[model samples]
Target: MSPIEALDFVGVALFAATGALAASRKQLDVIGFLFLAAVTGIGGGTARDLMLGVPVFWVERPAHVLACAATAVLVYFTAHLLESRYRLLLWLDAMALAAYGVFGAYKGLAVTGSATVAVVMGVLTGTLGGIIRDVVAREPSVLLRQEIYVAAAALGAATFLLLDRAGLPLWVTAGGGFAAALILRGGTIRYG
Candidate 1:
Protein backbone atom coordinates (compact mmCIF):
# COMPACT_ATOMS: atom_id res chain seq x y z
CA MET A 1 0.00 0.00 0.00
CA SER A 2 1.03 3.59 -0.50
CA PRO A 3 2.10 5.61 2.52
CA ILE A 4 -1.20 7.43 2.63
CA GLU A 5 -3.17 4.21 2.48
CA ALA A 6 -0.98 2.70 5.17
CA LEU A 7 -1.60 5.71 7.36
CA ASP A 8 -5.32 5.37 6.87
CA PHE A 9 -5.29 1.71 7.93
CA VAL A 10 -3.07 2.44 10.88
CA GLY A 11 -5.39 5.21 11.98
CA VAL A 12 -8.32 2.85 11.82
CA ALA A 13 -6.59 0.22 13.94
CA LEU A 14 -5.40 2.67 16.56
CA PHE A 15 -8.71 4.46 16.85
CA ALA A 16 -10.42 1.10 17.16
CA ALA A 17 -8.07 0.23 19.99
CA THR A 18 -9.01 3.42 21.77
CA GLY A 19 -12.67 2.54 21.41
CA ALA A 20 -12.08 -0.92 22.82
CA LEU A 21 -10.14 0.57 25.69
CA ALA A 22 -13.08 2.81 26.46
CA ALA A 23 -15.37 -0.19 26.38
CA SER A 24 -13.13 -2.02 28.80
CA ARG A 25 -13.20 0.93 31.17
CA LYS A 26 -16.96 0.89 31.09
CA GLN A 27 -17.00 -2.85 31.73
CA LEU A 28 -18.85 -3.42 28.52
CA ASP A 29 -19.04 -6.79 26.84
CA VAL A 30 -17.10 -7.91 23.77
CA ILE A 31 -19.97 -6.89 21.52
CA GLY A 32 -19.80 -3.38 22.90
CA PHE A 33 -16.11 -3.32 22.11
CA LEU A 34 -16.79 -4.40 18.53
CA PHE A 35 -19.54 -1.84 18.09
CA LEU A 36 -17.48 1.09 19.33
CA ALA A 37 -14.39 -0.05 17.49
CA ALA A 38 -16.15 -0.33 14.16
CA VAL A 39 -17.73 3.10 14.48
CA THR A 40 -14.63 4.83 15.82
CA GLY A 41 -12.51 3.33 13.06
CA ILE A 42 -14.66 4.19 10.07
CA GLY A 43 -17.09 6.94 11.00
CA GLY A 44 -14.91 9.85 9.99
CA GLY A 45 -13.58 8.32 6.81
CA THR A 46 -17.04 7.13 5.85
CA ALA A 47 -18.33 10.68 6.15
CA ARG A 48 -15.36 12.07 4.30
CA ASP A 49 -15.75 9.64 1.43
CA LEU A 50 -19.49 10.26 1.22
CA MET A 51 -19.00 14.02 1.12
CA LEU A 52 -16.38 13.65 -1.58
CA GLY A 53 -18.79 11.47 -3.54
CA VAL A 54 -16.41 8.57 -3.32
CA PRO A 55 -17.16 4.99 -2.29
CA VAL A 56 -17.16 4.67 1.46
CA PHE A 57 -13.70 3.32 2.22
CA TRP A 58 -14.60 0.46 4.49
CA VAL A 59 -17.42 -0.54 2.20
CA GLU A 60 -15.07 -0.67 -0.73
CA ARG A 61 -12.37 -2.40 1.27
CA PRO A 62 -13.57 -4.80 3.90
CA ALA A 63 -10.01 -5.08 5.21
CA HIS A 64 -10.49 -1.79 6.99
CA VAL A 65 -13.38 -3.24 8.93
CA LEU A 66 -11.34 -6.33 9.66
CA ALA A 67 -8.61 -4.16 11.04
CA CYS A 68 -11.08 -2.55 13.40
CA ALA A 69 -12.49 -5.83 14.53
CA ALA A 70 -9.06 -7.31 15.12
CA THR A 71 -7.94 -4.29 17.06
CA ALA A 72 -11.04 -4.38 19.22
CA VAL A 73 -10.50 -8.00 20.06
CA LEU A 74 -6.85 -7.45 20.84
CA VAL A 75 -7.54 -4.53 23.12
CA TYR A 76 -10.41 -6.29 24.80
CA PHE A 77 -8.07 -9.07 25.85
CA THR A 78 -4.99 -6.94 26.56
CA ALA A 79 -6.15 -3.62 27.98
CA HIS A 80 -5.99 -4.77 31.57
CA LEU A 81 -2.28 -5.38 31.24
CA LEU A 82 -1.64 -1.68 30.86
CA GLU A 83 -0.94 0.34 33.94
CA SER A 84 -3.10 3.25 32.91
CA ARG A 85 -5.57 2.48 30.18
CA TYR A 86 -6.60 6.13 30.03
CA ARG A 87 -3.07 7.31 29.33
CA LEU A 88 -2.58 4.65 26.70
CA LEU A 89 -5.87 5.62 25.11
CA LEU A 90 -4.76 9.23 24.92
CA TRP A 91 -1.45 8.32 23.34
CA LEU A 92 -3.06 5.93 20.85
CA ASP A 93 -5.54 8.64 19.98
CA ALA A 94 -2.79 11.15 19.42
CA MET A 95 -1.00 8.79 17.07
CA ALA A 96 -4.20 7.92 15.25
CA LEU A 97 -5.09 11.59 14.95
CA ALA A 98 -1.78 12.31 13.32
CA ALA A 99 -2.15 9.48 10.86
CA TYR A 100 -5.76 10.28 10.04
CA GLY A 101 -5.08 13.99 9.68
CA VAL A 102 -2.37 13.47 7.12
CA PHE A 103 -4.15 10.68 5.30
CA GLY A 104 -7.45 12.52 5.20
CA ALA A 105 -5.85 15.69 3.85
CA TYR A 106 -4.14 13.63 1.19
CA LYS A 107 -7.45 12.04 0.22
CA GLY A 108 -9.20 15.36 0.07
CA LEU A 109 -6.46 16.86 -2.03
CA ALA A 110 -6.49 13.87 -4.33
CA VAL A 111 -10.25 13.98 -4.77
CA THR A 112 -10.99 17.72 -4.72
CA GLY A 113 -7.56 19.31 -5.28
CA SER A 114 -8.58 22.05 -2.87
CA ALA A 115 -6.23 22.77 0.00
CA THR A 116 -8.95 24.52 1.99
CA VAL A 117 -11.22 21.52 1.82
CA ALA A 118 -8.29 19.27 2.49
CA VAL A 119 -7.63 20.88 5.84
CA VAL A 120 -11.26 20.66 6.84
CA MET A 121 -11.37 17.03 5.79
CA GLY A 122 -8.26 16.31 7.80
CA VAL A 123 -9.77 17.84 10.92
CA LEU A 124 -12.98 15.91 10.46
CA THR A 125 -11.17 12.65 9.80
CA GLY A 126 -9.02 12.96 12.84
CA THR A 127 -11.57 14.29 15.30
CA LEU A 128 -14.90 12.79 14.36
CA GLY A 129 -14.10 9.20 15.32
CA GLY A 130 -12.83 10.26 18.71
CA ILE A 131 -15.82 12.49 19.20
CA ILE A 132 -18.15 9.57 18.57
CA ARG A 133 -16.11 7.37 20.85
CA ASP A 134 -16.19 9.91 23.64
CA VAL A 135 -19.89 10.50 23.38
CA VAL A 136 -20.71 6.81 23.42
CA ALA A 137 -18.35 6.20 26.30
CA ARG A 138 -19.74 9.15 28.23
CA GLU A 139 -16.27 10.64 28.32
CA PRO A 140 -15.59 14.34 28.01
CA SER A 141 -15.31 15.27 24.37
CA VAL A 142 -11.87 16.36 23.24
CA LEU A 143 -13.40 19.58 21.96
CA LEU A 144 -14.59 20.38 25.45
CA ARG A 145 -11.21 19.57 26.91
CA GLN A 146 -8.62 22.32 27.14
CA GLU A 147 -6.24 20.36 24.98
CA ILE A 148 -4.54 20.88 21.64
CA TYR A 149 -6.49 18.30 19.68
CA VAL A 150 -8.24 19.95 16.74
CA ALA A 151 -5.52 22.51 16.26
CA ALA A 152 -3.01 19.71 15.91
CA ALA A 153 -5.12 18.12 13.19
CA ALA A 154 -5.46 21.44 11.36
CA LEU A 155 -1.76 22.07 11.63
CA GLY A 156 -0.98 18.60 10.32
CA ALA A 157 -3.25 19.05 7.31
CA ALA A 158 -1.91 22.53 6.62
CA THR A 159 1.62 21.30 6.96
CA PHE A 160 0.98 18.54 4.45
CA LEU A 161 -0.55 20.98 1.99
CA LEU A 162 2.25 23.46 2.37
CA LEU A 163 4.91 20.82 1.94
CA ASP A 164 3.13 19.33 -1.02
CA ARG A 165 2.85 22.77 -2.63
CA ALA A 166 6.57 23.19 -2.12
CA GLY A 167 7.06 20.06 -4.23
CA LEU A 168 8.46 18.04 -1.42
CA PRO A 169 8.49 14.25 -1.68
CA LEU A 170 5.46 12.39 -0.35
CA TRP A 171 7.48 10.86 2.48
CA VAL A 172 8.65 14.24 3.69
CA THR A 173 5.22 15.78 3.43
CA ALA A 174 3.49 12.93 5.23
CA GLY A 175 6.18 12.75 7.88
CA GLY A 176 6.09 16.47 8.49
CA GLY A 177 2.35 16.45 8.89
CA PHE A 178 2.35 13.42 11.16
CA ALA A 179 5.16 14.78 13.29
CA ALA A 180 3.56 18.19 13.56
CA ALA A 181 0.33 16.62 14.78
CA LEU A 182 1.94 14.17 17.19
CA ILE A 183 4.18 16.83 18.74
CA LEU A 184 1.33 19.21 19.42
CA ARG A 185 -0.98 16.54 20.78
CA GLY A 186 1.80 14.90 22.76
CA GLY A 187 2.74 18.23 24.26
CA THR A 188 -0.75 18.70 25.58
CA ILE A 189 -0.81 15.21 27.03
CA ARG A 190 2.61 15.70 28.56
CA TYR A 191 2.13 19.20 29.91
CA GLY A 192 -1.56 19.22 30.74
Candidate 2:
Protein backbone atom coordinates (compact mmCIF):
# COMPACT_ATOMS: atom_id res chain seq x y z
CA MET A 1 0.00 0.00 0.00
CA SER A 2 1.00 3.61 -0.44
CA PRO A 3 2.57 5.30 2.59
CA ILE A 4 -0.44 7.53 3.14
CA GLU A 5 -2.77 4.57 2.99
CA ALA A 6 -0.58 2.66 5.40
CA LEU A 7 -0.56 5.54 7.86
CA ASP A 8 -4.33 5.83 7.68
CA PHE A 9 -4.74 2.13 8.34
CA VAL A 10 -2.49 2.25 11.38
CA GLY A 11 -4.24 5.31 12.73
CA VAL A 12 -7.61 3.64 12.22
CA ALA A 13 -6.53 0.50 14.03
CA LEU A 14 -5.12 2.37 17.01
CA PHE A 15 -8.14 4.63 17.34
CA ALA A 16 -10.48 1.67 17.02
CA ALA A 17 -8.56 -0.22 19.66
CA THR A 18 -8.98 2.64 22.11
CA GLY A 19 -12.66 2.84 21.27
CA ALA A 20 -13.15 -0.87 21.81
CA LEU A 21 -11.41 -0.65 25.13
CA ALA A 22 -13.71 2.13 26.20
CA ALA A 23 -16.74 0.12 25.15
CA SER A 24 -15.48 -2.95 26.94
CA ARG A 25 -14.92 -0.91 30.09
CA LYS A 26 -18.56 0.04 29.96
CA GLN A 27 -19.59 -3.58 29.40
CA LEU A 28 -20.92 -2.77 25.98
CA ASP A 29 -21.85 -5.48 23.48
CA VAL A 30 -20.34 -6.18 20.05
CA ILE A 31 -22.55 -3.67 18.30
CA GLY A 32 -21.68 -1.00 20.81
CA PHE A 33 -18.01 -1.72 20.37
CA LEU A 34 -18.24 -1.39 16.61
CA PHE A 35 -20.22 1.80 16.88
CA LEU A 36 -17.75 3.35 19.28
CA ALA A 37 -14.80 2.29 17.19
CA ALA A 38 -16.25 3.75 14.02
CA VAL A 39 -17.06 7.02 15.71
CA THR A 40 -13.70 7.38 17.41
CA GLY A 41 -11.77 6.53 14.25
CA ILE A 42 -13.60 8.89 11.94
CA GLY A 43 -14.89 11.61 14.24
CA GLY A 44 -11.93 13.92 13.81
CA GLY A 45 -11.59 13.47 10.06
CA THR A 46 -15.28 13.99 9.60
CA ALA A 47 -15.20 17.23 11.54
CA ARG A 48 -12.15 18.49 9.70
CA ASP A 49 -13.66 17.71 6.32
CA LEU A 50 -16.89 19.41 7.23
CA MET A 51 -15.09 22.53 8.35
CA LEU A 52 -12.97 22.57 5.22
CA GLY A 53 -15.98 22.05 2.99
CA VAL A 54 -14.48 18.84 1.67
CA PRO A 55 -16.07 15.43 1.45
CA VAL A 56 -15.41 13.31 4.50
CA PHE A 57 -12.50 10.95 3.93
CA TRP A 58 -14.31 7.88 5.21
CA VAL A 59 -17.31 8.57 3.01
CA GLU A 60 -15.13 8.76 -0.05
CA ARG A 61 -13.00 5.82 1.02
CA PRO A 62 -14.96 3.10 2.72
CA ALA A 63 -11.76 1.29 3.58
CA HIS A 64 -11.35 3.58 6.57
CA VAL A 65 -14.59 2.34 8.07
CA LEU A 66 -13.79 -1.28 7.22
CA ALA A 67 -10.40 -0.99 8.89
CA CYS A 68 -11.93 0.48 12.04
CA ALA A 69 -14.63 -2.21 12.13
CA ALA A 70 -12.03 -4.93 11.80
CA THR A 71 -10.03 -3.41 14.63
CA ALA A 72 -13.13 -3.19 16.78
CA VAL A 73 -13.84 -6.88 16.24
CA LEU A 74 -10.30 -7.89 17.05
CA VAL A 75 -10.13 -5.71 20.13
CA TYR A 76 -13.54 -6.79 21.40
CA PHE A 77 -12.55 -10.44 21.51
CA THR A 78 -8.92 -9.98 22.52
CA ALA A 79 -9.55 -7.45 25.25
CA HIS A 80 -10.92 -10.10 27.60
CA LEU A 81 -7.64 -11.96 27.41
CA LEU A 82 -5.61 -8.94 28.44
CA GLU A 83 -5.16 -7.73 31.99
CA SER A 84 -4.76 -4.06 33.01
CA ARG A 85 -7.23 -2.69 30.56
CA TYR A 86 -6.50 0.82 31.79
CA ARG A 87 -2.87 0.69 30.79
CA LEU A 88 -3.77 -0.85 27.46
CA LEU A 89 -6.30 1.87 26.83
CA LEU A 90 -3.87 4.68 27.68
CA TRP A 91 -1.12 3.37 25.44
CA LEU A 92 -3.48 2.74 22.57
CA ASP A 93 -4.82 6.25 23.02
CA ALA A 94 -1.31 7.68 22.85
CA MET A 95 -0.59 5.79 19.66
CA ALA A 96 -3.81 6.90 18.05
CA LEU A 97 -3.27 10.50 19.14
CA ALA A 98 0.18 10.64 17.62
CA ALA A 99 -0.79 8.92 14.40
CA TYR A 100 -3.84 11.08 13.91
CA GLY A 101 -1.91 14.25 14.67
CA VAL A 102 0.61 13.48 11.95
CA PHE A 103 -1.91 12.34 9.39
CA GLY A 104 -4.23 15.21 10.11
CA ALA A 105 -1.50 17.78 9.76
CA TYR A 106 -0.48 16.23 6.46
CA LYS A 107 -4.04 16.27 5.21
CA GLY A 108 -4.53 19.85 6.35
CA LEU A 109 -1.36 21.01 4.64
CA ALA A 110 -2.31 19.18 1.47
CA VAL A 111 -5.81 20.59 1.54
CA THR A 112 -5.22 24.25 2.33
CA GLY A 113 -1.61 24.74 1.37
CA SER A 114 -1.43 27.13 4.32
CA ALA A 115 0.60 26.51 7.44
CA THR A 116 -1.89 28.23 9.75
CA VAL A 117 -4.85 26.31 8.40
CA ALA A 118 -2.89 23.10 8.61
CA VAL A 119 -2.11 23.65 12.28
CA VAL A 120 -5.74 24.34 13.13
CA MET A 121 -6.93 21.38 11.12
CA GLY A 122 -4.35 19.13 12.68
CA VAL A 123 -5.50 19.98 16.20
CA LEU A 124 -9.12 19.48 15.16
CA THR A 125 -8.35 16.15 13.57
CA GLY A 126 -6.32 14.85 16.48
CA THR A 127 -8.67 15.75 19.30
CA LEU A 128 -12.17 15.45 17.88
CA GLY A 129 -12.15 11.66 17.85
CA GLY A 130 -11.45 11.33 21.55
CA ILE A 131 -14.02 14.01 22.24
CA ILE A 132 -16.62 11.99 20.37
CA ARG A 133 -15.58 8.80 22.09
CA ASP A 134 -15.85 10.32 25.54
CA VAL A 135 -19.20 11.88 24.75
CA VAL A 136 -20.56 8.64 23.43
CA ALA A 137 -19.30 6.77 26.46
CA ARG A 138 -20.80 9.46 28.70
CA GLU A 139 -17.44 9.97 30.33
CA PRO A 140 -15.63 13.23 30.98
CA SER A 141 -13.73 14.00 27.84
CA VAL A 142 -9.95 13.77 27.93
CA LEU A 143 -9.68 17.21 26.36
CA LEU A 144 -10.92 18.60 29.63
CA ARG A 145 -8.19 16.90 31.59
CA GLN A 146 -5.56 19.00 33.33
CA GLU A 147 -3.03 16.71 31.72
CA ILE A 148 -1.42 17.81 28.47
CA TYR A 149 -3.77 16.17 25.98
CA VAL A 150 -4.82 19.09 23.76
CA ALA A 151 -1.51 20.76 24.46
CA ALA A 152 0.32 17.82 22.97
CA ALA A 153 -1.79 17.92 19.83
CA ALA A 154 -1.26 21.64 19.53
CA LEU A 155 2.47 21.23 19.95
CA GLY A 156 2.60 18.54 17.29
CA ALA A 157 0.54 20.60 14.90
CA ALA A 158 2.73 23.64 15.44
CA THR A 159 5.84 21.55 15.00
CA PHE A 160 4.53 20.25 11.67
CA LEU A 161 3.65 23.72 10.46
CA LEU A 162 6.95 25.20 11.52
CA LEU A 163 8.94 22.38 9.98
CA ASP A 164 7.07 22.77 6.74
CA ARG A 165 7.69 26.48 6.81
CA ALA A 166 11.38 25.81 7.36
CA GLY A 167 11.43 23.85 4.10
CA LEU A 168 11.62 20.45 5.72
CA PRO A 169 10.41 17.52 3.65
CA LEU A 170 6.86 16.26 4.19
CA TRP A 171 8.03 12.95 5.63
CA VAL A 172 10.35 14.69 8.07
CA THR A 173 7.68 17.04 9.29
CA ALA A 174 5.11 14.29 9.62
CA GLY A 175 7.43 11.91 11.42
CA GLY A 176 8.67 14.61 13.76
CA GLY A 177 5.15 15.70 14.57
CA PHE A 178 4.10 12.11 15.28
CA ALA A 179 7.12 11.48 17.47
CA ALA A 180 6.63 14.68 19.41
CA ALA A 181 3.00 13.91 20.08
CA LEU A 182 3.77 10.33 21.08
CA ILE A 183 6.49 11.38 23.51
CA LEU A 184 4.43 14.11 25.08
CA ARG A 185 1.31 12.00 25.43
CA GLY A 186 3.25 9.02 26.70
CA GLY A 187 4.92 11.22 29.30
CA THR A 188 1.57 12.51 30.42
CA ILE A 189 0.20 9.00 30.71
CA ARG A 190 3.23 7.92 32.67
CA TYR A 191 3.72 10.81 35.03
CA GLY A 192 0.87 13.26 34.80
Candidate 3:
Protein backbone atom coordinates (compact mmCIF):
# COMPACT_ATOMS: atom_id res chain seq x y z
CA MET A 1 0.00 0.00 0.00
CA SER A 2 1.02 3.56 -0.54
CA PRO A 3 2.06 5.55 2.51
CA ILE A 4 -1.18 7.50 2.55
CA GLU A 5 -3.33 4.38 2.33
CA ALA A 6 -1.30 2.73 5.06
CA LEU A 7 -1.71 5.76 7.32
CA ASP A 8 -5.46 5.73 6.63
CA PHE A 9 -5.59 2.08 7.64
CA VAL A 10 -3.69 2.84 10.82
CA GLY A 11 -6.06 5.69 11.58
CA VAL A 12 -9.08 3.43 11.08
CA ALA A 13 -7.65 0.71 13.28
CA LEU A 14 -6.73 3.14 16.03
CA PHE A 15 -10.17 4.73 16.02
CA ALA A 16 -11.80 1.33 16.11
CA ALA A 17 -9.70 0.41 19.10
CA THR A 18 -10.77 3.60 20.85
CA GLY A 19 -14.43 2.80 20.16
CA ALA A 20 -14.03 -0.67 21.61
CA LEU A 21 -12.35 0.80 24.66
CA ALA A 22 -15.34 3.07 25.14
CA ALA A 23 -17.65 0.09 24.83
CA SER A 24 -15.68 -1.79 27.44
CA ARG A 25 -16.11 1.09 29.86
CA LYS A 26 -19.85 0.76 29.43
CA GLN A 27 -19.68 -3.03 29.85
CA LEU A 28 -21.09 -3.57 26.39
CA ASP A 29 -21.31 -6.92 24.71
CA VAL A 30 -19.22 -8.01 21.74
CA ILE A 31 -21.87 -6.84 19.33
CA GLY A 32 -21.87 -3.44 20.93
CA PHE A 33 -18.12 -3.28 20.66
CA LEU A 34 -18.38 -4.19 17.00
CA PHE A 35 -21.03 -1.55 16.46
CA LEU A 36 -18.99 1.22 18.03
CA ALA A 37 -15.85 0.05 16.30
CA ALA A 38 -17.39 0.11 12.86
CA VAL A 39 -18.95 3.50 13.38
CA THR A 40 -15.88 5.15 14.84
CA GLY A 41 -13.57 3.60 12.31
CA ILE A 42 -15.47 4.60 9.19
CA GLY A 43 -17.62 7.51 10.21
CA GLY A 44 -15.18 10.33 9.51
CA GLY A 45 -14.00 9.03 6.17
CA THR A 46 -17.55 8.33 5.14
CA ALA A 47 -18.55 11.88 5.91
CA ARG A 48 -15.55 13.25 4.05
CA ASP A 49 -16.30 11.13 0.99
CA LEU A 50 -19.94 12.11 0.99
CA MET A 51 -19.12 15.78 1.25
CA LEU A 52 -16.56 15.42 -1.50
CA GLY A 53 -19.05 13.52 -3.68
CA VAL A 54 -16.74 10.55 -3.84
CA PRO A 55 -17.52 6.90 -3.21
CA VAL A 56 -17.76 6.00 0.45
CA PHE A 57 -14.42 4.40 1.35
CA TRP A 58 -15.45 1.34 3.33
CA VAL A 59 -18.27 0.63 0.88
CA GLU A 60 -15.74 0.48 -1.90
CA ARG A 61 -13.18 -1.45 0.16
CA PRO A 62 -14.73 -3.92 2.55
CA ALA A 63 -11.35 -4.49 4.17
CA HIS A 64 -11.72 -1.29 6.11
CA VAL A 65 -14.86 -2.67 7.78
CA LEU A 66 -13.15 -5.97 8.32
CA ALA A 67 -10.22 -4.23 10.00
CA CYS A 68 -12.62 -2.49 12.34
CA ALA A 69 -14.38 -5.73 13.19
CA ALA A 70 -11.10 -7.43 13.85
CA THR A 71 -10.00 -4.59 16.12
CA ALA A 72 -13.27 -4.78 18.02
CA VAL A 73 -12.84 -8.49 18.63
CA LEU A 74 -9.27 -8.06 19.77
CA VAL A 75 -10.14 -5.26 22.14
CA TYR A 76 -13.12 -7.20 23.47
CA PHE A 77 -10.92 -9.95 24.85
CA THR A 78 -7.98 -7.76 25.80
CA ALA A 79 -9.51 -4.56 27.07
CA HIS A 80 -9.89 -5.96 30.55
CA LEU A 81 -6.16 -6.39 30.82
CA LEU A 82 -5.51 -2.69 30.51
CA GLU A 83 -5.54 -1.02 33.88
CA SER A 84 -6.44 2.25 32.21
CA ARG A 85 -8.30 1.77 28.97
CA TYR A 86 -9.28 5.39 28.88
CA ARG A 87 -5.65 6.48 28.88
CA LEU A 88 -4.80 4.08 26.11
CA LEU A 89 -7.81 5.28 24.18
CA LEU A 90 -6.64 8.87 24.47
CA TRP A 91 -3.18 8.10 23.21
CA LEU A 92 -4.51 5.97 20.37
CA ASP A 93 -6.92 8.75 19.53
CA ALA A 94 -4.08 11.22 19.37
CA MET A 95 -2.32 9.01 16.90
CA ALA A 96 -5.48 8.52 14.90
CA LEU A 97 -6.21 12.22 14.90
CA ALA A 98 -2.79 12.97 13.52
CA ALA A 99 -2.89 10.31 10.84
CA TYR A 100 -6.39 11.12 9.72
CA GLY A 101 -5.73 14.83 9.76
CA VAL A 102 -2.91 14.55 7.24
CA PHE A 103 -4.65 11.90 5.18
CA GLY A 104 -7.82 13.93 4.97
CA ALA A 105 -5.98 17.09 3.96
CA TYR A 106 -4.03 15.25 1.31
CA LYS A 107 -7.18 13.68 -0.07
CA GLY A 108 -9.07 16.95 -0.16
CA LEU A 109 -6.23 18.80 -1.87
CA ALA A 110 -5.85 16.00 -4.37
CA VAL A 111 -9.52 15.88 -5.21
CA THR A 112 -10.46 19.56 -5.22
CA GLY A 113 -7.15 21.41 -5.19
CA SER A 114 -8.68 23.70 -2.58
CA ALA A 115 -6.74 24.42 0.60
CA THR A 116 -9.89 25.51 2.41
CA VAL A 117 -11.58 22.21 1.63
CA ALA A 118 -8.43 20.34 2.58
CA VAL A 119 -8.19 21.90 6.02
CA VAL A 120 -11.88 21.46 6.67
CA MET A 121 -11.79 17.87 5.57
CA GLY A 122 -8.78 17.23 7.76
CA VAL A 123 -10.55 18.65 10.83
CA LEU A 124 -13.66 16.63 10.11
CA THR A 125 -11.73 13.45 9.50
CA GLY A 126 -9.74 13.87 12.67
CA THR A 127 -12.51 14.90 15.05
CA LEU A 128 -15.80 13.43 13.80
CA GLY A 129 -15.13 9.81 14.82
CA GLY A 130 -14.32 10.62 18.41
CA ILE A 131 -17.31 12.94 18.61
CA ILE A 132 -19.53 10.19 17.33
CA ARG A 133 -17.96 7.68 19.70
CA ASP A 134 -18.49 9.91 22.71
CA VAL A 135 -22.09 10.63 21.74
CA VAL A 136 -22.86 6.94 21.28
CA ALA A 137 -21.15 5.98 24.52
CA ARG A 138 -22.87 8.80 26.38
CA GLU A 139 -19.50 9.99 27.53
CA PRO A 140 -18.49 13.63 27.62
CA SER A 141 -17.58 14.54 24.09
CA VAL A 142 -13.88 15.19 23.58
CA LEU A 143 -14.62 18.10 21.30
CA LEU A 144 -16.88 19.62 23.93
CA ARG A 145 -14.24 19.28 26.61
CA GLN A 146 -12.06 22.28 27.35
CA GLU A 147 -9.02 20.72 25.84
CA ILE A 148 -6.90 21.41 22.77
CA TYR A 149 -8.45 18.58 20.73
CA VAL A 150 -9.96 20.41 17.78
CA ALA A 151 -7.15 22.92 17.68
CA ALA A 152 -4.65 20.12 17.43
CA ALA A 153 -6.50 18.73 14.46
CA ALA A 154 -6.75 22.10 12.75
CA LEU A 155 -3.07 22.74 13.39
CA GLY A 156 -2.04 19.44 11.89
CA ALA A 157 -4.27 19.84 8.86
CA ALA A 158 -3.14 23.37 8.17
CA THR A 159 0.47 22.43 8.76
CA PHE A 160 0.21 19.68 6.17
CA LEU A 161 -1.25 22.08 3.63
CA LEU A 162 1.26 24.79 4.31
CA LEU A 163 4.24 22.46 4.18
CA ASP A 164 2.98 20.81 1.02
CA ARG A 165 2.43 24.18 -0.59
CA ALA A 166 6.01 25.05 0.33
CA GLY A 167 7.06 22.12 -1.88
CA LEU A 168 8.05 19.86 0.98
CA PRO A 169 8.27 16.13 0.43
CA LEU A 170 5.39 13.89 1.41
CA TRP A 171 7.31 12.50 4.36
CA VAL A 172 7.98 15.96 5.73
CA THR A 173 4.42 17.16 5.25
CA ALA A 174 2.79 14.07 6.72
CA GLY A 175 5.29 13.70 9.50
CA GLY A 176 5.11 17.36 10.36
CA GLY A 177 1.33 17.20 10.59
CA PHE A 178 1.41 14.06 12.69
CA ALA A 179 4.01 15.41 15.06
CA ALA A 180 2.24 18.73 15.39
CA ALA A 181 -1.02 17.01 16.35
CA LEU A 182 0.54 14.54 18.75
CA ILE A 183 2.52 17.24 20.53
CA LEU A 184 -0.53 19.39 21.13
CA ARG A 185 -2.82 16.55 22.11
CA GLY A 186 -0.16 14.94 24.21
CA GLY A 187 0.24 18.11 26.23
CA THR A 188 -3.48 18.10 26.91
CA ILE A 189 -3.37 14.55 28.11
CA ARG A 190 -0.34 15.22 30.27
CA TYR A 191 -1.46 18.47 31.82
CA GLY A 192 -5.16 17.74 32.06
TM-score, cand. 2:
0.93
Models 1 onward score TM values of 0.98, 0.93, 0.97
Q: Is candidate 2 or candidate 3 better by TM-score?
A: 3
Weakest ten-residue segment in model 2 by summed lDDT: 1-10
Kindly indicate the candidate among 1 and 2 with the higher TM-score.
Answer: 1
By TM-score, highest first, what's the ranking? 1, 3, 2
Q: Per-residue CA lDDT of candidate 3, range 1-192, in tens?
A: 777777799999999999999999999999999999999999999999999999999999899999999999999999999999999999999999999988999999999999999999999999999999999999999987845888888899999998999998888888898899889988889987
lDDT of 1 at 131: 95
**Number of the predicted model whose lDDT against the real structure is largest:** 3
After superposing candidate 2 on the true structure, give the runs of residues whose Cα lies further than 4 Å from its correct spot. Answer: 1-4
lDDT of 1 by residue, 55-157 (tens): 9988888989998999999998898898999999999999999999999999999999999999999999999999999998898897789447999999999
lDDT of 2 by residue, 58-149 (tens): 89999899989998899888989988887898888887777777777778888888877887787788888888999999978888774587
Report lDDT per candidate: 0.92, 0.83, 0.93
